[model samples]
Target: MRLTYSARKRLGATSAGVVLTVIALVMLAPMAWMAFVSTKPDADIFSRTPLSAPEELTGGHYANLFDQFHFGTSITNSLVIAGATVVISLLLGGPAAYGFARYPWRGSGVALAFLIVARMVTPAALVVPMYTIMQNLGLLNSVTGVIVGVSVLNLPFVIWILKPFFEQVPKEVEEAAELDGLTPGWVFFRIVLPLALPGIMTAVLYSFLAGWTDLIFPMTFITDANVMPLTSSLLQMQTGYRIYWGELMAGGIVLTLPPVVLCFALQKYLLRGLRTGY
Candidate 1:
């Protein structure tokens, strides 16, 4: 017997729910294991079943992160780098994207295409040249070097992400603002930008992640323990022979939390921006 439309809809919904639930479990399983291992004693990490509760738990690994490894320094450095990257990307990308959307001069599409292509290139491929450039500019072994490197790499992506959102803004709104005697600059700052907040938030999150999680530039350009970000610092947990699994897991948790928290806080804007920008 053929199912009614309502019955078919219910069946479809059930299937989607089941699929999504399974996918969520699959994705979350590794994170759960890492968190579990992080809290367990060194001896207990591999002893019982991987997911089983530990006989004892300790916060020593977390303590070691601060006491022995000075993980706090890494956290501070990463925040500075990420914050600077976000500011630079938005200040530069926001206006460029607006220009691209509103004023399509000759060869503008070609220029935008080049920007997207640049973003797609592997960071690994650019490392040698980037390193040489930073060294030439006396930015090596400093947080500023890493910040500059990350900003260069992330700028193209920010432009690409923000362009669509600017395009989505109604030209009519800008014209209306002009009729009310608002200058172009004031119209963008007061009217158009507010409407594009969702896109701006999305761009902010991406720019922040690019800086926070970048390892290549930091590792290549910075050697000072004080200047290293969390991504590069996490590698200190490994030596030639043995890995400090417990402390590594703890550090991983620390590194992961900021981005996750930011995403949760900005989830509404992210969803709205993605929906409307496309």
Candidate 2:
């Protein structure tokens, strides 16, 4: 059958819209379920019956999160560690990426290969050696220790991810800046950084997520409840006998928010970073 131009266009748009809607729902289902479960009572969590709503809608879980699990302190610790990890990784990795991007040297390729190998090194492999190092340095059970440890793990990835962006920058810009007598430091901070903002943003977000989602290092290195990150404290929510499902899910939902918000806020530039590393 012959279709009218407008009708065909409309049908195509509708089909695309439906496909995207389904994909979006699939992507978001876990988070939606988590939110739903957070409001549910302990009995409703594992029961066979369907939940139309919470057994009793209340803020009890969040209150319990704050009280019993010491979630407030853990959240604070996690934020501090993740924040420090982002800053440290960016500060250290930025220069390394710039060096790799600009100063290709005798062993630069091999050095980058080694860095990639390090990035692939599992946290499990490093845990024993790191724990020993932390012990010797007396860095165990400290947020600073976790930040430094996580940064060391994350920095190589940051540099590798960011180096391409720096390389993507036009060499003429650097040449012009140099000819204009701008110092290397000034050129990097002013010209290169501004152009490479998107990649830097992506690197920061990934570095933050790396630190935020990590449970292993924190679990192994941290001995004190006061120092446990949200990831480690999240495990505490699953106590054997009395699993307060609402509290557990509430904490999970809360912990999940920051990264989600960050991604949404930077999503446009994130795509650019993905494409051209710019």
| Reference-based lDDT, residue 234, model 1 | 88
Highest-scoring model, lDDT: 1
CA lDDT, candidate 2, residue 83: 88
lDDT for predicted candidate 2 compared with the true structure: 0.86
Candidate 2 lDDT over residue span 26-108, tens digit each: 99998988888887766677778645764576677788898999998998898888889999999999989999999889999
RMSD of 1: 2.3
- The runs of at least 3 residues in candidate 2 whose Cα sits more than 4 Å from the true structure, single-residue gaps closed, are 2-13, 273-278
- Provide the lDDT at 151 for model 1: 89
Best by TM-score: 1
Query: Cα RMSD (Å) per model?
Result: 2.3, 2.4
**Candidate 1 residue-wise lDDT, 133-250, digit = tens:** 8889888989887887788789888887888888889999999999999987888899989999878989998889889999998888888888888998888899899899999999
